[model samples]
Target: MGQLLVVRHGQASFGADDYDVLSPTGEEQARVLGAALADLAPDLVVHGSLVRQRRTAELLAAAAGWDVRLREDPRWNELEDLAQFAAVSGSPDGLDRDGFQQWYDAAMARWTGGEHDHDYSEPFVGFRDRANAALADVADEGTVVAVSSGGPIAAIASVLLAGDATTYGRLLPGIVNAGITRVISGRRGLTLLSFNEHQHLPPELRTYR
Candidate 1:
């Protein structure tokens, strides 16, 4: 059986013109996470093609001093409907602050509820399928670390937990960026061993708001 460790990308420049880049704090977070997992010596390290996700994997590899093979897999990319939501709703920059919360909440509601069907972005079903395929590619017997975004991580966790789509929609809210979720392969299938573990970081570093 294989062990899969899913990691959400470090903090990104959310709401910036180039949201693909990671903030300075995000860089440090990735380094710290890398140090935390140094002993694991993962056999395979994979990340989404998105810059932020790839950067996180790079930073982690640098910190861990491991020359593990890194693979770029697009299936791990995030659900990007937020960009469309911002465009349609006229959301301003800097979602880490206050005012963006209301706009984000409304947009997330629409995105998750499938009300944004007409929006130009990946549909929920498509995102789920992509993530599931990426997870299914993991080989047995060695640890695989997949660096991805919150949405894809949640989607994978949902499948591991409930075996269907409806449960993912209802349970994905709890996942956070830079968090770790563990899945262990077994006779039955992938078993979700943990979800959203961030105890390695201090209180100040833990931010899902």
Candidate 2:
């Protein structure tokens, strides 16, 4: 059986000018997670092409002291949040955190509801399909670790667990930054062993954003 460990990128610069970059806390989180992952001795390390994802992968690899070259894959990148936000009406971009969450929730609900097929940046079906394909392509014989965003990580988990679109939608908000999701693929096919683990991080280090 081959092991697949999917990691959500550390906390990003939410609400900042460049949201693709990781925050200082995020860098620390990645370093801590990397040290723990080093013990696993992953045969391959992979990440999406996004800046935040790439930075997380690099930081973790360095902290782990693993010399493996990271495999860049765009299919593992996050769904387009700006596109989703634009699809909805009423510019809640300037709203407070609580207000924004409400607006964002409604927007996500509309997206996952399958109402706007042509409206999304990347159609939900395409996103789901690509996520599955990416996972299959990286199923190495030994342990494999992939650093990506929460959306792709959750999408893959939802598929392997036989969850529907609603399950996938529900998962996005709960994934902790720098959390790990483990799976095993063999003749029997992919099986999810764990989801959203961050026990290695202290209370102050845990975050979701």
Candidate 3:
């Protein structure tokens, strides 16, 4: 069985004007994860095209001293329709962390419900299928490491585990910053080895945002 190491990109600028970039703590988390996984000697390093995902992949490769060139595949990117979510959730003038989470959860549910496919540029099924395709492409021989956002990672895990949208909803929120998820390709096809493993990170570095 071949192993696919899927990493959730580190924490992004949650409150900053630009939310695509990684926070200082996120950089540290990436470095820590890199050092933790140094023994595996991955053959290919791939990441979503988002700034945070790309930066995490670069930092992790540098920290781990892996010579492989980082690859970018947008299929691994997050569900990136913030305006649609805000509109669907009726976001207020200013949303704090808790408020945003409340709205985001509602928006996520509606998006995944398959009722509002017209509202989003990319529907849930489309996102999930693309994510699955990305996983299939990278699950080739040798150790493959991928840096992606929580949405797509959860999508991949949910489809493999239960083939349900509820599973994806359950898996998304708890994915830690720079968390590790392992999948194994075997006779039975893809299997979820682990999800959201963050034991390598210190207590202070653990974040979900």
Candidate 4:
């Protein structure tokens, strides 16, 4: 049996020119989280290919004083459907925050309701299959920390919650930036230990924007 820690990437430059980079405060938040986890000494560290996610993992590894050996898995990346919707809707660059959110909500609702096919984006079923496969691969004797975005993390949690896709839509918004969720592997399967933990961070460091 093993333990899996799912960590949301620290705060990024939300509503900025580029959303892939971590903010200065985000780096510090990662460092603090690293310090909090140093004693645990996880066996494996994984993150998505996105720069913000990778950078957070790097910062955590540095703070823990460990030589980082990170594995990048695209399956852990967030949904790209919103980006496609934005493009399709002819949203202008850098000023479509509200529009993007609206599109995202509608797309997610459609996704959860099984109205969209894989051609639309990474469908819910596909996301679950790939994410579960990745989780299964990492279930071992030691702890594994996976750094990812809100969407994937929420999907994983939704699966763990043993509910339908609609539940995920209701649960995702509650996840805070840089939050931690614990899932333990056991004889039966993976069991969720905790969800969206941010007790280690002060209020100032918990901002998602």
Question: How do the residues 26-104 of candidate 4 rate in per-residue lDDT, one tens digit apiece?
Answer: 8998999998888877888998888999999999988988765689987778767556555434444565678667767
**Winner on lDDT (2 vs 3):** 3
Q: Write the per-residue lDDT of candidate 1 for residues 17-46, one digit (tens) a residue.
A: 888898887888889889988889789999
What residue runs in model 2 are displaced by over 4 Å at the alpha carbon?
88-90
Instruction: Itemize residue pairs with steric clashes in candidate 2.
Output: none
Off by over 4 Å in 3: none
Model 2, span 1-209: residue lDDT tens? 89999999999998798999999999999999999887777888989999999999999999999988688999999998766666554577678989887888887777777778777777777788898899999886478999989889888999988998899988888899999999998989889999999998999999999
**What is the per-residue lDDT of model 3 for residues 11-40, given as tens digits with 9 covering 90 to 100?**
899869999999998899899999998888
**CA lDDT scores, all candidates in order:** 0.81, 0.88, 0.89, 0.81
Question: What's the CA error at residue 119 for candidate 2, in Å?
Answer: 1.7
Q: Model 4, 31: alpha-carbon shift in Å?
A: 0.8
**How many residue pairs in model 1 have overlapping backbones?**
0
Alpha-carbon TM-score of each model against the true structure? 0.84, 0.95, 0.95, 0.90
Worst 10 residues of 3 by lDDT: 84-93
